[model samples]
Target chain A: DTAVSQTPKYLVTQMGNDKSIKCEQNLGHDTMYWYKQDSKKFLKIMFSYNNKELIINETVPNRFSPKSPDKAHLNLHINSLELGDSAVYFCASRKRFQETQYFGPGTRLLVL
Target chain B: DQQVKQNSPSLSVQEGRISILNCDYTNSMFDYFLWYKKYPAEGPTFLISISSIKDKNEDGRFTVFLNKSAKHLSLHIVPSQPGDSAVYFCAASAIGANSKLTFGKGITLSVRP
Candidate 1:
């Protein structure tokens, strides 16, 4: 079974539209996180959830929402997207110790 | 505003030679450092890591060294192989809060056989 998986491998949307990228992990990890990688390849953490509850919500705009329905699933929803939103979004899972983060295939979102 | 930085955008090394990838961090608060390798169209995979308390950590041919006072860390891959070609990223996480990591811009390493 796949340890971590994310849907919509590619997404292209117009500005001001809403879209979502879903992620699921069967590793039974308690922690889930969302990371954004810009064109320059710098990675920044956007959000983190533990057991369906939000834990680390960075300074991201309210348009970016992370919803964890259960311990195994975490999804990202974006609203009123902008051109700057064109980047690769990755979903990751890790244990409490933060020992290692297992990442899933990223979703490339392009807002025009 | 970038906390972690990898100056070299790319490097080429012959097989069986040593590959040294350097990384620097501006934040002294970063206590844990890690190295991750990524292939094209794939997520990064953890290669190695070192804590502030330990200056060096080694796993097989990969050795990670940290300089606390200098806030610099490097990953050395002895006898680099062609299969080792990929983009390597340096990451740092602060102590006490497991608060996610800050990654560098990444350096592409090409190992020629």
Candidate 2:
């Protein structure tokens, strides 16, 4: 069983299209997060949810939205996806604030 | 702006030697520092961390050292193994930020067998 998992590990879509990346965690954590790793290998946190409530929202584009239906799941939906959005998106979970975050295998998105 | 920086993009070490990865942060607001190891297709795995309150924390062969005065931290792996070959990312965040980690550019560590 995967402690943290994401679906469609590989994603290929055209620019301006809409796509979603699904994530789930079984660690019984209180917080979940979404991070984007760019081509230069820079990882940046996009959003974090605590107990199904939005907690941290970095200055990411409005096109990137994070929806957490429950404590264990956080899904990312990108609208009007741009070529610059081509990167590996990672999902993670944490027990609480400032705790270690367990990450998923990542979804590699390629925008053509 | 990149608050966390990993100046070295890559490092090579011989098996059984010690591997040291350095990180620096411009923002003193960062109260915690962590190092993560990532393989090809998988996400990063937590390697070690050090809180701002402490200077050092050890786990098995890995040890994290933090120097708050210098705004610097490092991950030291003793007797580096081939399996440890991966990209290592240095991340940091404030305690109240709910784990909003700002990660470095990452350093690819290659342990030569």
Candidate 3:
């Protein structure tokens, strides 16, 4: 069974388009996170939610928003995507007390 | 600014030899450190971790050593196999900080037979 899964493993959209990426975890984790890995292979955290509550927001632009409908699901929505938004987005989850994170396969986004 | 740094972009090692990947951090607040391995088209998987209090952690062929004074850490894989080739990431996090991990640009390791 896949512990963490992300939908639409590949996405290609034009500038000014709106897109959303869905993520779900079956590991019974209390925390979920969204990360952006750029072309340089630098992985950075974008947002983190614990039990559906926003806990960490890493100075990301307001155009990007993360919503967690429940403890098991966290989704990312981009408004008016720009060319600079093209990158690999990863979804991760971890238990409240566990330090190790479980990551999904990742979604490659290309905004032309 | 990046808090975690992996100076080496890539490392090539022979099979059955030891592979060492180094990482450094600038933040003293970080209390936990971890190493993750990633393959192409796949997300990173947890490989090993070490706490700030301990200097070393080992799991089978993988061993992580921590130097608190230097704020440096390294992952040592002994007798590396060809299947062990992948990009390795170093991550750090502070306790009670919602477990937010700060990651460094990964280093690619190629284990050649």
Please report the candidate that would top TM-score against the real structure: 3
For candidate 1 chain A, the 10 contiguous residues with the lowest summed lDDT are A93-102
What residue runs in model 3 are displaced by over 4 Å at the alpha carbon? none
User: Which numbered prediction scores highest in lDDT against the true structure?
Assistant: 3
* Candidate 3 residue A62 C-alpha distance from true site, Å: 1.1
**Could you give candidate 2's per-residue lDDT for residues B18-38 as a string of tens digits?**
999999999988898889999
Q: Tens digit of lDDT per residue, candidate 1, span B1-113?
A: 98999999999999999999999999988888999999988888889999999999999999999988888999999989999999999998885434688899999999999
lDDT of 3 by residue, A5-82 (tens): 999999999999999999999999999999999988899999999999999999999999999999999999999999
lDDT of 1: 0.91
Fnat of every candidate, listed in order: 0.61, 0.80, 0.80
lDDT of 2 by residue, A6-91 (tens): 99899999999999999999999989999998988788889999999998898999999899999989999999999999999999
Docking class of 1: medium
lDDT order, best first, reads 3, 2, 1
Which residue pairs collide, candidate 3? none
Judging by TM-score, tell me the better candidate of 1 and 2. 2
The RMSD of every model to the true structure, in order and in angstroms, is 1.3, 1.2, 0.7
State residue B42's C-alpha deviation in candidate 3, in Å. Answer: 0.4
